[model samples]
Target: MNDSVKKRNMKVYIGKIKVMVFERGVCMTECDILIKGEKVEPVKEFVYLGSLFAYDGKHNTDIERRVNGALLAIMNSKSDSREARLAVHNGVLNPIYMYGSESWMWQKKHESGINAVAMPPLRSVWCLIKINIKTVMLESGMA
Candidate 1:
């Protein structure tokens, strides 16, 4: 590893990167990898491309992170116009929730996590608008 760094004339910053090993089966073993004279600590999970991957094949961590990020995006978009805010909710938050969803064998907890993040913006949009009485009556079959 050190040799490759030296050969490429590249500098490695030890603090900025992590090294994790994903195991397939049950085995009690510890292995260390070295790069540029730095020891890499092994982790059970790692975040890559904004998604979390774990050795235990659980997506709780990933779901929590995505939900939290979506909520943060909504909270921080207070200065944007209504349409822009909706765009943030739809474009940014929805994609974050939907990304890698096909790979997930979703449980009730995962569905709840997704709903917890999705509902706030929708409720906000509904409350922010004034409903005309005629439209409301028509929708209620009174028109």
Candidate 2:
């Protein structure tokens, strides 16, 4: 094997997420990013939101920043079809969802929450989902 080739292999891959799942003493794992790698954000926290959601943002600054923004958005709305959830990375639209995309944009009339999504071309994000009860109800039932 060439020296250069070996060095390259030793390098970490970017934009990857790593997941660890353990049950009944058996261990299962998956990942999307490598620590200290190019294109990958730092690991911030380790979280498991039941079967609904899961991610690590404890040690990752990028993850922490984004998550903080998301939480803020969720808090502000609090009671309607707010943002619900956010899928952001490096202030860009992250299309790839690691096994959880269902109901991300989910809306519940009685719910109160939103996602503080970030955008590109600078810290900007559109579409916060403003729900007008009058407008929503007008489109349904015998009016």
- Candidate with top TM-score is 1
Candidate 1: residue pairs that collide: none
**Residue 75 in model 2: lDDT:** 38
TM-score of each: 0.44, 0.17
Clashes of each: 0, 25
Off by over 4 Å in 2: 1-92, 96-99, 103-105, 108-115, 119-143
Please provide, for model 1 over 1-143, each residue's C-alpha lDDT reduced to its tens digit, 9 standing for 90 to 100: 67887899998887776665545576524767777667777677766556767765554546556656536655446565666665666666667777777755556778666666566555454343555545533432323
Candidate 2 per-residue lDDT over residues 1-143, each given as its tens digit: 23554677764344355344322332334445434533344332344322322232111123224445444544344352323322223213333211233423233521222122222201222233554444432432102
Q: What TM-score number comes out for model 1?
A: 0.44
| Backbone clashes counted, model 2 | 25
Candidate 1 ranges beyond 4 A from true positions: 1-46, 62-79, 128-143
